[model samples]
Target chain A: MIDNPYYSHEFHGDYELVSIGRLDLEEGGSIPDCRLAYTTFGTLNEARDNAVLVTTWFSGTHQIWRDQYIGDGHALDPAKYFVVVVDQIGSGLSTSPHNASGDNAAISMSKFPHVRIGDDVVAQERLLREHLGIETLHAVVGGSMGAQQTYEWAVRFPEKVKRAAPIAGTAQVTPHDVLFSRSLVEAITSDPGFAGGEYTSNAEVVAGLERHARIWAVMGFSTEFWKQEVWRALEFDSKEAFLEGFLQPYFTVMDPNDLICMAWKWQRGDVARHTGGDLDAALGRITARTFVMPISEDMFFPPRDCRAEQERIKNSEFRVVDDVLGHLGLFAVAPTYMPQIDAHLGELLDGPA
Target chain B: MIDNPYYSHEFHGDYELVSIGRLDLEEGGSIPDCRLAYTTFGTLNEARDNAVLVTTWFSGTHQIWRDQYIGDGHALDPAKYFVVVVDQIGSGLSTSPHNASGDNAAISMSKFPHVRIGDDVVAQERLLREHLGIETLHAVVGGSMGAQQTYEWAVRFPEKVKRAAPIAGTAQVTPHDVLFSRSLVEAITSDPGFAGGEYTSNAEVVAGLERHARIWAVMGFSTEFWKQEVWRALEFDSKEAFLEGFLQPYFTVMDPNDLICMAWKWQRGDVARHTGGDLDAALGRITARTFVMPISEDMFFPPRDCRAEQERIKNSEFRVVDDVLGHLGLFAVAPTYMPQIDAHLGELLDGPA
Candidate 1:
C-alpha cells in the first residue's frame, strides 16, 4: 500500500504484516490502505479457542510483548495458547503517519488524523477476523497505551475478549494524565528542528526526544528509584550517563510525528464517549473477566484511579503491583513485580475467574 | 555599570535599582559592576531595628513581596517593619545574563557564569549593609527559590539574620528537584529558536518557554487543584484558556537566558556546600529563629523534606501549611494559606523563640 522505507513490514523471523485496507477513523477522517504489523507464536488450537491478543504500548512495537511476557512458564505462554502481538496503528511498524499512503498520503507529519483507542480496537478487530480468522480472543493483555487498547477491546466488543488485563493505564485519562501526555507532545513539537513536524529525519529532533526521555525518567519511576540511585543498576557511571545512554538512545529512534499522534489519542482516552459520557455505563458494558492492574507508585495512573474504574466494571478484579519502579513496574524491569503479574495472568488464563 | 536596555534601572514608582558594585561569584568568575533592583516600603525605625529583608523567587522581581506580602496587616507589615524587597541576581530586573557588563559581557545567554544560592545571599547582604545602611535584618522571608536564599542567609551569615521563614523550598536541591530544574532548562535549550542561547528576543523562543510553563502548570500545583478545576478561580473559561492567557503571557515577557541562568543556580542549591558538604553542620549554623513552612500538597518540596531539615536546625520550627494549592500556596493564591502565613510571621516577629 505504501513504498515508504520507514514502514517496516519486513518479517523478522516470525513477525508479519497484514493489510486491513481503508480505515474510517473515530473522528471525521479515514486512513487509506491501512496495515497492521504483528507477530505470533505457538499454534492456534483446533477448536480456534486458544488465541490471546497482546497490544503494544506507546512507542513500543509488538516485540515488547514477545520479549517480556511470552515465554515458557511465563504469562501468555506459547505452549498453552496462540499469542498475537499487534502493533498499534501509530506505532512505526503499523500504518503510522510516517508510512500511510493512497488517500492517507496527506496524513503525513502534522496532518495525521486524530485516532482514539476505539478506532485502534476497530482496526485490530479487522486484523483478527480477516487476517488471522480469530472470532474471539482467549485473553487480551497490555500495559500503558496497550492497556488503554485492552480496555477498549473489552468495552467496544464485549464478547470478543473472554478475559482482559489492563495494566498501568486507565479507561479514562485524568487531567493529570492529560497534562503529562501534553508535555511529551509539547517537548517534541517545541523543537525548532521539528519544522512544524515536517522534519526530514528523526535525527533532527534528537534534542526534543532527549528532553522527552528526561521527563519520562522523572515521571516514569518513583522518587525512591532516584533516591536509591537505580541508575547504578543500569551500570551507568551517573544519572546523567544513564539518561544519555539509556533514555536518549531508546527514544531517539522513534518518529516524533508518530509520538505526537499517539499522545493525541492518549489525551482523549475516555471510554465514556461511547456511552454518552457515562463512565460507569461504559465500564459496565464489559462482560469479560477483567483484571485492572495499576502500579502502586504510578504518579500518572495511580492505583486509586484504576480502582475507581475497576469497581464500576462488573466481574472485574483490582490488583495493584507494589513496586518502587512506579509506572515502569508494568515493564517487568525488577523481579519483584513479574511473579505478581505472572500469577495474576496465570489465574486469568488457566483458572476460573 | 551596564547600559543594557533590558536592565530597567529607572524607578517605576516604588521600584528602584542599586549598583552593588563588582560581585565575585561563589563558583569562580566575577560579575563586574553587578546591580540589584529592589523596592522598599514603610519607614526605617529610628534604631533601624525593624528592617525586614524579603527576597524574590525564580523569575520574580522585588514587586512580588510588595503586592503579595507587604501590606498594612499582611505577613510582612510595612507599618511595623521596614520591608526591603531585593530581586535575586539573574532575575530580569537584576544584573542577569541579559544585563551584565564588563568581564561578564561575554557571559550573555548560555555562557552566563554559574551562581549558587550562597552567591545570591552574599550579594543581598552587601546590598543591605552598603546601600540600605542596614547591618542586621529583623527577619528574612521568602518562598521557593527565595526561600533557598533565605536559608543561605541564615546559615552563611548567622549573626545578620534574627528570624527566617523559608516557605515551600528546601536548603538543598534534592535529586528530584534537580531533575525538574534540569527538564525546564533542557526544554529551553532544545528549541531550535534557542540558537544555542543566542536568540535576539523572547518572542523568538516562545514555544520552548510555553513548554517550560506547561511543566510548571503540572508540577507547581497539586493533582487536587486540577481535579477540582481550580483554574476557574482565576476566571478562566477552561484549562486551555488558562494556559494561553496566564501561563504563556506570564513567561513570554521573561528573557530565556535569565531563566536558564536562574535554573542553573536553582539546581546547585545546597547550603551543605558552604559547610563542607555536611547538611546537619550547615543547618546547625543557623542561629536565626526559623519557621520552615512547607506546603502540604507540594510535590516538589514536600513537608517531610522540609521537616527533616527543620529538625536539624537549632531554634527552628516546622509548620506545614495545610492547602491543596501545592507549591502555589506560597504565592498566597488562596485565602486559606495567607492567614496561616500572617499568623506565623506575627508570632516570629513579636514573640520569643
Candidate 2:
C-alpha cells in the first residue's frame, strides 16, 4: 500500500474490510481477491432485515456518512437501523491505485483495471450477501458517484432493494458532463510529474492536482454562492484566499492515477447499457421506492436532468433541494443540507417496499 | 509580427496599424511606443461624423466582425458608416507579448505590462483623434472583452460617443468569473513546458495549451448546446472530436504569455474602478444611448448580470439574445446570434442620440 498519512483511518476515523474475492468487472477483467473497505453503525437484528447500505461519492470514504447524517434524531439514525457505508473500489480506502499491495499488487497504480458503476454494485452485493449475511436491503442511499451506484443497485437487483435515493447524479451521464470529466483526466496526464503513472508519491504530481482542484472550484459551487460571497461562511475573506487555503490544498494530496480511474468511469456511467442504450427501459427495471434528489443550483447535474430521469422510474419522486454550494453541497456545506436529506430519506425508509 | 500564419492578414484579411505614441495605462506603467492593429470598412466621409468604433474580444483580431455583422445588409453597414475594428492591446495582433520586438522588446514575453479594460479605450480614443483625425464616434460596438472596452468608451469619454452596445459581457466581472479565469491561468503555469512563462515557443507548451482548450470547452458552451448535440451542426461527430479538432488547435498556436496577459486583464475587467468600486456611479456616467446586450445562454456573463448593470445606465436598454453556445456565442455559433445583434445595433445606431 502507498504509505500516505493523509487518507489514513486516523484522518477519516475507523473502517473494516470485507474480502469478496476475485470479482469480475463489467468492462472485462477481474480484481483478484478484491477487498471492500466499509464501516457499519447500529446493530443487525435476528431477522437480518433492518440493514441499509450507503455508498460514497468521489474521493469520499466510509467515514463521510458517519456523525453528519447517521446520528440519533436524524433520518438515518443508526440506533434504529443498521447503516453500512461502503467505500467504492478505486476510492483509495478500498482497492485503489494508491493502495493495492500484497496479494493485490498486480493491479497497483498504472496496472489497475477499468471499473464501472456496475462493478461497484456487484462487489457490494457480495459483501452484503456473503460476508455480512444480508439477503435484502431496507434502503440504499448515496450522493454523486454514490448516487450512480444507487441507481445500479435499484435496477440491477431490483427485488433486493426496498428503497433507493440517488442525489445530485444522473443515470446516464450527459454529453456536457462526459466532456467536463475529461478535463480532470487531461489535467493529470498533462503533468510531467505523473511520469506515466510511476510517480513515487502524490507530492510529485502536486501541480496537476492543484489544477484539478481549481477546475472543481469553478464548477462545484453555484453562481449564487460566489455572487453572495458565501465563502465568508467558510472563513475566506476573498476568492483568492479560498483558492489558496481551501482548493489548492484539498486535491494536492490525492493520487492522480486513482482519480483518473474514477473520472474515466464517471464519464462512462450509463445504466442504459443494460437495455442497449434505452434509458427508459433501464430505469423501468427499478422496483424499489426511490427519491431522485438533485440540488436546485447544481451546475453538474441540474434539477431538470434529474427530473427527466425521475419520470422513468415508476415509484420515484422528484425532490429538488436547495444548496448554494451546488454539486459540492454533497459535503453538507449548506446548513439545511443534512436536515433536508433526513426528511426525504426518513419518509422513504418508513414507506412500503 | 510573431510569424504566426494562423493570425496573419492572409487568414484574417486586410488590416492596418496606427501608432499612438507612449500612452499611460490604467493599472500603472505604459506600453512604450504602443501601436494599435485595426481594419476599416467603407469610407470616412468628409464630415467624419459617421465613424464607428468596433472593439475585438480576447484572442480576436480585426477580422471577426467582418462579413458576419459588418456587411451591406447587416447592422454595421460600411456603406452608411466608416466601421473601424480595432484589436485590443496584448491580443497578439496588437503589440502583444508574442510580437513585441524592436522598440517594444522591453514589454515582450514575460516582461509584458499589466492592462485593464480602460487602457484599451484610452488608446483607441487617441488613435481616433490623433491619427484618424476623428473627434467623435457615431457608436461603439463589441462583445466579451470587446464589450468591456465598449463600456469604457461610453463612460470614460462620455461626450465622444453617440451610441454604445456592450454584448455578452459585464462592466464588472463577477466573483464567480474571477475564479473561473484563475483556472485557465493555473492550467498554463502548471505545465512543465511553461517554465515560469519562459517557454521557447507555443509549440513547446502544447500540453498546457491543450489543457487550456479543454477547460474552455466545459464552460464555453451552454447546457442546452451539449444536451442538443450542437457540435453536429459544426460537422463534428462528438464533443471529443470538437476538443481535438477545434479547441486544442485554436489555442495551441498562440503564445502562452500573451494568453495569460489577456486572462489577467479579463479577470480584472471592472469599470467600477472609475467610481471607486461604485458600479452604479461608473455606469451612471454614460451620456451615450446604450444597449446592454447579453446572450441569454452565456454562462460567463449571464443576462441577469447585464440586466443589473443596464438598470444603472441612465439611457441603456437591456437586450438578451438567445444563443445555445453560451459565452462562446460571441463566435456566432448560433444562427440567431448575428441577427439579434444586428437588430439591436440597427435600432441604437438609427435612433436619436
Candidate 3:
C-alpha cells in the first residue's frame, strides 16, 4: 500500500486487494487474476443487509467520497451503514493504465481492452458478492463519474440495490460531453511520445496532459464563478506566475494515463445498453428509489437531463441543486448542497416506499 | 496589399503606416511616433460627414466586417459612409512584437504601453482628424474584440459617433475570459523558441499555440454545436486522418503571432482606465444611442452580461439573440441577427437623436 502520512483519521477505512479471477473485456478479451483496490467503512452488520456502495468523481480516489459523507450522523453514517468505496477501473488505485496486469498494460487504443462503466459495476458486484458475502445493497451513491456508476448499478442489478443517489450525473453522456471527453483522450494518446502507448522510457506527455486538464477546468466551472468569486481579488506578478499559480496546480493533481482511460470510460457511459437501447426501459429496471440531483449551472447534465431521468424512473425524485458552482459545485461547494442531499437520504433511509 | 486570386479582385483597400504621434504610457511613461497599420473602405465624402469607423475582432483581418458590413445598403454601408478599420497596435500588421518602429515593441509589463480599448479609440481619433480630415463618425460597429472598440468609442468619442452597435460582445470580459486569454498568451510566449519575442527560428511553442486554438474553438461554440455541427458528422478512416481533418483545420485559420497579439489585446480590454479604477464612472461617458446585441449561447459574452451593460449605459438598448452557435453565431449565422441589427442601424443612420 502507498503510504500517505497526511491521511486524516476522519476516514478510518479498511483497504483490501480482492482477486476477481479475470476481466472479460468488451473486445472479446480477458485478463486473469485481476485484482481490485477497494476500501470499506462502517460495519456490515450480522445480516450483511446494510451495505451502501459509494463511487467517486473523475480524478477522485476511493478516499474521496468516503471521507466526505461516511462518518457518524452523516448520510452514509458508519454507525449504521456498511459503506463500500471501490476505486473504479482505470482510476490509478485500481486496475489502471499505471498498473496493467501484464505487458498488455502498455497496449495502444487498438490493443487495450474496452472497459466500460458497466464493466466497473460488474467487477464491483463480484467483489461484493465473493469477498464481502453481500447479496444486497441498501444503496449506491456517487457524483459525476461516480454518479454514472450509480446509474449503471441500478439497471445492472435491479434487485441488488434498494436505493441510489446519482448526484450531478447523467443517464448517458450527451454527444457534446462525448466530444469533450474524447478530445481529452485524443490529446493524451496523440502526443508523439505516446509511441502507441508503449514508450515506457519516455517521459509522459506533460504538455498534452496539462492541456487536457486546462480544458476540463474550463468546462467544470461556470462563467459566473470566475467573474464573481475570483477575477478582481486575484493578481499575479507576471503572466507566467498566473499560469503556474492557477493552471499548473490542476494538471499536477492528475495522472495522464489514468485521465485518458477514465475519460474514455466516461464517454462510453450508456445505461440504455443494459435494457437493449431503450433508455426508458433501462430506467424501468431500476427497482431502487433514486434521488437524481442536478446542479443548476451544470451545462453537461443540466436540470433538463435530470428531469428526463426522473420522469422515466418509477421511484425517482428530481432535486435540482441551485448553485452557481456549475458541475463541480456538488463537490467544491458540497457544504451548501449537502444538507439537501442528506434530507432526501434521511427520507429514503428511514422507510420503504 | 496581399493579392487574392480566388475572388479575382485585387484587394483595393489602401494600407498606411500612421504615427499615433505618441503614447504617454499608463505607468507614467511615454513612446513617440508609435506606428500603426490602417486600411480604409468607401469614399470619404467631401464634407467628411459620412465617415464610419469599423473595428476588427481578435485576430480578425481588416477584412470580414469590412467586406461584410461596409458595402452598399448594409449597416455602416460605405456607399454612404467612409469606412476605416484600425489594426490593434500589437498585431503583426501594426507596430507590434513582429515589426516595431524603433526598438522591439515594449512588451515589459511596465514598458508594455498600457493600451486600453479607450486608447485604441483615442489613437484612431488622432489618425482621423490629422490624416483623413474627418472630425466625426456616422457610426462605429464591431463584434467580439471589435465590440471592445465600439464600447471605447462611446466612452472616448461619445460626441463623435452618432450610433454604435457592439455585437456578440460585452462591456468588460469576465474574469474567466481574462484568465483563459492570459493562459493562451502564456502558452505562446512561454515556448522555448520565443526567446523573449525575439527568436529568429520558428516558435517552439507552435504546438501549444495549436492546442490553444483547439481549446478556443471548443469554448467559442455551444455544446450543441460540437454535438450537431462539427465533430459528429466527421468520419475519419484513421486517427491521423481525424486529427488532420478536424483539428488542424482550426489551428490553420489563425496565425500564432496574430493569435498572441489578439489575445493580449483582449486581456487588456477596458473601455476606461483600469488604473483609474472607477469602472462605473467611465461607463457613464457613452453618449451614443448604443445597441448591444449579445447572443445567448456566446461563451465569451453571455446575454446577461449584455443586459448588465445595457443597464449601465444611459441611452442603450439591449437585444438578446438566441442561437446554438454561441460566439460564432453572430458571425456565421449573421443572417438571422443582421436584420435586427440593420433595423437598429436604420434608426441611427437616419439621423442623430
Candidate 4:
C-alpha cells in the first residue's frame, strides 16, 4: 500500500474491510482480492432489523457521513439504528487505483478498470450478506454519487432495501451531468504533470486539481448562493480565499487517478443500462419505498429531473429539499435543510417496514 | 509581430485601425499609441445620420458580425445603415496583450493591463469621431461581450447613441458570471505550460485550451440544447466529436494570453462603476432607446437579470429570445431566433431617432 499521506487512506472512528476476492466490473474487467472499507455506528439489535446503509460520494470517505449525519437526534441517528457507511471503490479507503493489490496489482492509475454504481452495489450486497451476517437493510440512503449508489441498491435489490433516499442525484446521468463529469476528468488528465496518468506525486497535478475545484465552485452552487455571499458565513473573507482554502485544498489531498476512475463511473451511472435503455422500465422495477430528495436550486440535477424519475418509481415519494446551496447543500451547508431531511428520513425509518 | 498563423490575427473583408495615441485605462494603466480595429459596410449617409456601431464579444473580431448578422434583410442590414463593427481590445485584431506596443511593450501575457468594457467604448468613440467622421450613431448593437460594450456606449455617451440593443449580456456582471470568468481564467493559467504567462507557443498550452473548451461546452449551451443534440445540425456525429472539431479548435488559434486579458475585462464588467455602484442609477443614465434582449434558456444571463436592469432604464424595452442554445444562440445558432432579433433591430433602426 502507498505510504504517502497524500495518497494513502486515513479515517476516523471504527472501521472494517471486507474482501470479496474477485469482483467483476460492469464494463468487462475484473479486480481480484477486491476489498471495501466501511464504518459501523450504534449497534445491530438482537433481531438485526434496525440497519441503515449509507454510501460515500465522489472524493468522499465514510468519515464525512459519520461526521455530518451520524449522531444522536440527527437524520442518520446511530442510537435508533445500526448505520453502515461504506466507501465506494476508488475512494482512497477502498481498493482504489491508489491501493489495489494481488491480481488487481496491475490496476493503477490509467490501468484501473472502469467501475459503475451497480458494480459497487453488488459488492456492498456481498459485504452485507456474507461479512456482516445481515439479511436485509431497513434503508439505503445518500446524496450525490452516494445517492447514485442508493438508487442502484433500490433498483437492483429492491427487497433487500425496504426504503431508499437519493438526494441530489439521478438514476440516470443526464447529458448535462455527463458533460460536467467529463470536464472534471479532462481537467485532471490535461495537466502536463499528469504525464498520461503516471504521475509520481499529487503535487505534479495540483494545478489541474485546483482547476477542477474551480469548476465545482461554479457548478456545485446556485446563483443565489453566490450572490448572497454564503462563503462569508463559512468565515471566508473573499471568494478567492474560500476557493484556495476550502475547495482547492479539499481536492489536493485525494488521488487524481482515483477521482478520474470515480468520475468515469459517475458519467456512466444509468439504472436503465440494465433494462435495455428503458428508463421508465428500470425505475419501475424499484420496490423499495423511496424518498427522492433533490435540492430545489441544484443546477446539475434539478428537481424536475428527479421528480420525473420519482414519478416512474411505483412506491416512491418525491421530496424537495428547500435550499439555495444547490447540489452542495447535501454536504457543504447541511444545516440549512437538515430539519426537513431529518423529518423525511425519520418517517422512512420509523414508519412500517 | 508574431508570425505564427495560430497566434496572429486574421480578418475578412477590409478593416482599418485608428490610433488614439496614449489611451488611459479605467483601471489605472495606459497603452501608448493605442489603436482600435474596425470595419465598415454600406455608405455613410451624406448627413452621417445612418452610421451604426457594432461591437465584438470576447475572442471575437468584426468578422463574426459580418458573417452572422450583417447582410441584406438581416437585423444589422447595411443597405439602410452604415455599420461599423469594432473589435474589442484584447481581441486578437485589436491592441491587446499579444499586440500592445510602445511603453506597454512589457505588458504581454499576464502583464496585460486590465481592460474594461468602458475602456473599449471610449476607444471606439475616438475611432468613430476622428477617423470615421461620425458625430452620432443610429444604433449601438451587439450580443454577449459586444452587448456589454453596447450598454457601455449608451450609458457612457447617451447623447451619441440614439438607439441600443444588448443581447445575451448584462449591463453589469453578476456574481455568478464573475465566478464563471474566474474559472475560465484559472483553467488557462493553471496549465503547466502556461508557465506563469511565459509559454513559448499556443501548442504548449493545448491541453489547457482543450480543458477551457470543455468548460465552454458545459456552460455555453443550455440543457435542452444538449438534450436535443443540437451539434448534429453542424454535422458532428457526437458531442465529443463536436468538441474536438469545433470548440477545442476554436480557442486553439487564439493566443491564451489574449484570452486571459479579455476574461479579466469580462469579470470586471460593471456599468455601475461610474454611478457609485448603483446599478439602477447607471441604467437610468441611458437616454438612448434601448432593447434589452436576453436568451430565454441562458443560465449565465437569465432574462430576469436583464429585465431587472431594463426596467430601470427610462426608454428601454425588454425582449426575450426564445431559443434553447443559451448564450451561444446569439452567435453559433442564429437561425433559431434570428427572426425576432431582425424584427427588433429593424424597428429600432427605422424608428425616429
Candidate 5:
C-alpha cells in the first residue's frame, strides 16, 4: 500500500489498516488518529481462545512473519490457530512519519510523536478488542525490538497474554545498548543529506542510511560470522559484494526520520518502569507461561543478560537459538534456522498454558 | 610540537622531528619530504645493541609511551636499555594530513596518500639506521596498531629485532575487523562538515568525530565494562559523564582526515602480502623471540585471533593480559595494569634472545 519512494520496500502480503481513534503516547504526546496495520492468517473460533499475536521488529512488517515464521507445517501453523501479525508503529506499512495523511497530516515527517513499547501494546490491545473482537491473546511472540514489546505485554497486561516468547531482547535495555542505539541515531542526523529530516526522498539521505546499515552489519552479525565469511553461503561473492548487495539496498529504501524515531524508542525500552525501577517486581507480574529465548551469539542481548531476567520471572525458561547469525538470525537464515526457532515456539504453544 | 589546534591535544614530551626524505609508499605513492617525530630515553650502550623501539598505535603518540609504559624500575627502564618511541606516520605528531608542509603541501588533507603498515615499518627502519646510527634493536614492542607494526618489523627484517611483542593486534587483519575499520572511516566522511576532507577545523567536523568516538566506546570497551559501570572507578559519576568527559574530548580535538588515513591503513595491515596471502609462511619468518599478547576481553583483536598467529611463529608465547578495559586498556589502567605488562616484557628481556 506504500507508494512513496522515501519508504519503498517489498511488502506484498494483504493487510488491513484500522483506525484505533486518538491514542495517547507514553512520552507526553498523542497520535491524532492512530492506526494499526495487520493481517490474519486463519479463522477465529467461536470462543476466540485460539488466537495468537505476532509482533514485528524494527523496520519489519507482518510480511516477514508470513514469509519466514508462519506456514501450514511450521510451529505457528495458520490452520490450527488464528495468527494475527501486527506491524509496529513507525513501520512503513503502518501510519508512519512518511505516510501520515488527511487529519493526521499535521504530524508527518519529523513532526510524528515519539512512540514507546507500552504505546504499541496499548494500540494493539485496542486493535484486537475493538476491531477484531478478541479480548485475549493465546500467545505473544517476537524478536529483538519485537521482543521488547512482548515483555511489555506480559508485564503491563498480565492476564491478557497466555503464553509469551521474547527472543534476543532484554526486559531492561543495558547502558551499552543505550549508547549503541545513540550511535545509530547519530549516524543518520549527522549526514548532510538528512537536512533536518526535510529531505525529499530516501535517495536524499542515502549516505546516512548507509552508515546506519553499516553499524547494524557490525553488531547484528557475530564475529565468527564475518571472520568465516558466512555471506558466501547466501551467494555473496565477496565481503564488499555482500555489503553492497545485501545491507545497503534494504536501508536505502527506508526513511531516515522513521529509523531515528524507532531508535529513540528502542533505547528506552525498560519494562522496569512499570514497578518504579524494581525489575524483579516488574517481571514478577508476568502470569504468562514465558520462554526467554536469546540467540547464543547475539551481541546486543547476550544469553547471560537474558538469563538474568528469566531467573527473575516466576515461571520462565531460558532457551537459546544457537545461531552464528547473532541478533539478525531471524532472517536470511539457513534451512535449520527457522526449525530451531519453531521447535521452541512449538514447545511453548503445545505445553500447558 | 604539534600546536595546530586542528590536530591538538596535550603532548608535552620533547620530540625531535627528523626528515626521512622521499619515502616511497608501499601503496604506490610517496611522502615527498617524509618526517618522523621521535623521543629517546636513556643512553644507547657503547655496543649499539641496547636500543629498544617502541611504536605508537592509532591516534597515539610518544607521550603515552612516556607516561604509562616506561619508568626507572619498569620493564622498559630508561636506566638500562635506550628506549625510542616513534610516532606512526599518520598520527598528528608525525607527518599527517593536517600538518603536511613545504614541498608536501600538494598531498595535504584529502590529497594525502594512503599509508600501509609495511610503509610504517620501513619508515621506522630508516629512522633507526639513518638517524641514530643503530644497527640492531634489543626489543620492539607496541599495542593495537603498534602491534601490527611489531609483527611487520619481525617478519620483514628478521635479523634487526631481538625480541618482539605485539599486543592486541593481528599480523593479518580479519574480515570482521575490515568492516569495523570501514565503519569508522564512513563515520568521518559522511559528516557534512567534513567537506571531502577540506574541513577548516576539527570543530567543523565535531559531530562526525563524535560518531567515531561512540563506535570506539561500543567495541573498544568490553560489554561487562559498561554493564558493571566500570567508569565509576575512574570518578565518572554517570555513563553520560564518561562519554562527555572521556571519549568525546579525546576524539573531538583530532583531525578527521588524519584519523581516516590511519583507519584506511589499519584495515589493510596484512603481512601475508609478503608471501601472497600465505599467513603461515609470512609469520614463520619471525626469528625474534616473540610474545603475542592479547587482552582477554578485547573485541577488536580477540585472543583466539592472536593465538592463531602466534602458533605459526618459530619461537613465540601467547601471553594474555587478563584485563577488562579491552582495546583501550593501552591507555586506561588499574594499579596492577602496568606491573602485569611490565612482568611480561621483563621476562622476555631476561630470556634467551
Candidate 6:
C-alpha cells in the first residue's frame, strides 16, 4: 500500500504544563486528569485585563485559531492582549473520543455525558480560573460551534465577558441543523463495522470519518466553491489523482472517533437549554455587547439562524456577510468581511462603555 | 404513526399513461416493454410537425414538466406543439428500482446496468418512432437531469431535434459531483442491515435515505433558502415539525432504491463519452440549434460547464440564470428565464432546415 500524504500526524507540544485538572461534567461523568492544550503568542499586560478567550470551531483544534489570529496587531493583537485558546472536550487536544481512558473512550451519543455548549464553556472557564487566573475576559470570540461557546460565555457568566463576537454561528440548532447533524451521526453509526462505536481498530471508523468529511464539504462551502472544486472543474493526471486531492482531504486529516464525538456534541448544543430552556431568561443575562456576524452564504449556521438569536439578545447587533463562500465565508472570504470584523472588534476594544 | 401528507394519493391525472412503447437500450440491455406515464394539457395543432419532447429531472416523474410547462403560450406551449414526455427507465414513471422486475430490480451501484445519457435519448427516440410515429421534433427541453437527457437527444439523433433547450444543467458531473455521489453511495451501503443488497427483511434503509436527502437538500438550495425555509420564516409548529418538512420529504417522496438508482444513473451519465469521449465530436453531431441556460448558483451544473458544451456545439448560445435558488431555480424562478426559453423554442419549432 502507498503512503497517503493527506493523513495528518499527531502533534505533541514541546512545552509541558505546570499543572493539569479534571472537570466533572454535570451529567455525572468526569474527564479524569484532563490535559489541556494551550498556546500563547504575545506578552500579557501587568493587569491581565486585556485577555481574550478564543473558542475553537467543530473539528478544529486549538492550533487552528492560534495559527490564524494569534499574531501581532491582528484582530487578536497578542502583543497588546493575552490570547487564550482552549480545545473543547471531544476535540483531539482535550479529553476526547481518541485519548479518553477506560470507559470514557468507548462512549458515544447514547452513553456519552450530556455535554451542552455551556458545559464546554464551563470547562474552559474552570481552566482559565485555575491556570491563567482569569476572573474576567476582555472579549470572547468564536465561529460555528465556537460561536455557540461565545453565546454560552455571555449568558452563563455575563459579568465575565465584556464583548462577544460570534461569527457565522448560531444560538441554537435549527430544525435543519439538527437534520444535518443527524445525517452525519447516521452516516457514522450505520457503518457495518462501526458495531455501535465499539470497533477494536480504526478502519471502519475512518470510512465513517471520510463520509463525514464529504457531508461537511457540501454544507461548509457555497455552491460556487463546489462548482469550482468538484465535478466538471476537477482536473488531474488521473481519477486517482483527483480523488487524492479532492476527496481524501476530507477523511485523511481527522481521526474517525473525533468525527463521531464532535458531531454528537454539535447536535446537542443549546444556549437556552443550558439556562434551563428559558430562552428569554438566558438572553436577559447577557451583559456583554454582542456582534453577531453570520455569512450570507453560510450553510451550517445560516445568517438567519444567527439573526434569530440577535433578536433575542438585549445588546446584540447582527451583520450579514454577503460573500459567496457560504458558511466558510467567515474564514475563506475573510477579505470581504474583514472590515466589518475589524470595525466591531475596534469599537469594543477602543470605546469606553 | 404520524400522517405523512407528503405521500399523497396520487395527483390528478397522475400515473395515467398517454402512450406506450419499447425503449431499446442498444447497450446490450433491452427494456423489452416500456410504458410512459405522462399527462398533457391544451390542444395539439393539425400539423404533427409541431411536436415538443419534454424530459423530466431525476426523482421528478413526467408530471412536473408536463403539468407545469405544457400550458398555452407557456415555454412548452402544448396548443402549438404535440408534446411527448416519456418517463426514463430506472425513474419512477417507467421501469425503476421500486417496481422493477427480474434483473433490473434490487440493483446496487456495482450491479446496476450501465445506462448513459445516450441510453435515455435512444429510448425516447424509439418512443417517438414506434409509438408516436413522429419523424421530427420541434424542440427537446428539460431542466437539470432533464437537460442532460435533452442534450442527449440533440446529439444522439441530430436530425430528430430541430432545437434544444437544456436548462440548469452541466455538460458532465464535476469532481464535486463525483465526491457527493460517492458519499451518498457510501452512506447507503454502510447501513449494516443493507446486507449488500441481500437484506430483504427488517432492514432500516431510512437512515441512508435520510442522509441522501440531507445531502440533496444541501446541494439543491443556498444558505439563504434554509434560513428562510427552516429558520426565521418557518411556518412549522415545532422543530420536529420543521425537520419532518425539511428532512423527511426526501424519504417520503422517493424510495431508497429509486434514489440510489437515480444517483447511479446520474453518476454514469457522460454525453462526451457517447461520441467516443470526444466532446467536440458529440457537439458536432448536434445539428439542432441549441440554447443552454445554467443557473448561477447551481453548483451541480454551473454556467461554465454549460458554456464549455455550448462552445463545442456548432450552433449554440448560452444564457446564465442569476438566481440564488441554485439548481432548483430553473423551476422555482422560471419567470426570469422563460422569455429566453420561449424565444429559442419558438425559433426551433418554425421548420426543419
Per-residue C-alpha lDDT of model 5 across residues A278-342, encoded as one tens digit per residue: 99999999999999999988877889889989999987899898988888887837676888888
Docking class of 4: medium
Interface DockQ per candidate: 0.61, 0.72, 0.31, 0.63, 0.74, 0.36
Position B107, candidate 2: lDDT: 80
**Candidate structures ordered by TM-score, highest first:** 2, 5, 4, 1, 3, 6
i-RMSD per candidate, Å? 1.3, 1.3, 3.7, 1.5, 1.0, 2.8
Full ranking by DockQ: 5, 2, 4, 1, 6, 3
Candidate 1: which docking quality band? medium
**Number of clashing pairs per prediction, in order:** 1, 0, 0, 0, 0, 10
lDDT of 4 by residue, B107-188 (tens): 7656787888888988888888988899999999988888889999888999999999998998988888888877777777
DockQ of structure 6: 0.36
Q: What TM-score number comes out for model 6?
A: 0.77
Which stretches in model 2 have alpha-carbon errors above 4 Å? none
Candidate 4 on A283-345: residue-level lDDT in tens? Answer: 888988899999998878889889889999888889998988888887746466888888888
Q: Whole-model lDDT, candidate 6?
A: 0.66
lDDT of 2 by residue, B90-162 (tens): 8777778778888887887788889888888889988988888889999999998889889888888999999
Could you tell me which residue pairs clash in candidate 4? none
Q: Estimate each model's TM-score.
A: 0.91, 0.97, 0.83, 0.93, 0.96, 0.77
Judged by TM-score relative to the true structure, which candidate is superior, 3 or 4? Answer: 4
lDDT by residue (tens digit), candidate 3, B114-173:
455666666778888988888988888778888988888777777897778888877776
RMSD of each: 3.2, 1.7, 5.1, 2.7, 2.2, 6.4
lDDT per residue for candidate 5 within B1-353, as digits (tens), equals: 12366443334458888999998999888999888989999999999999999998988888888988988878999888899999998888789998887878888888999999899999999999999988899999999999999999999999999999998999999887887878888888877788898888878888888889999898888877889888899899998899899998888888887898889889998999999999999998999999999998787698988998999998999889888787888884766578778899999976788
Q: At residue B31, what lDDT does model 3 achieve?
A: 48
Off by over 4 Å in 4: A4-11, A45-47, A101-104, A108-110, A332-334, A351-353, B4-11, B100-111, B195-200, B332-334, B351-353
Q: For candidate 2, lDDT tens digit of each residue in A72-149?
A: 888888888999999988887778887888888888889888999999999999999998999999999988898899
Off by over 4 Å in 5: A1-10, B1-10
lDDT of 3 by residue, A1-353 (tens): 11222222333345676678777876456645466778888789998999989886677767756656667767778888888888787665666665564533444333456678888888989999999999999998888899899999999898999998898888777666775675566566656556565545224556655655555556676777666663223465543464567655545444566667788789878899876789989889988998888888785766776787889999988877776768867553445666766776767765674
The parts of candidate 3 lying over 4 Å away from their true place are A1-14, A28-31, A45-49, A100-114, A182-213, A230-253, A272-287, A305-315, A332-334, A348-353, B1-47, B99-116, B186-206, B230-250, B272-275, B347-353
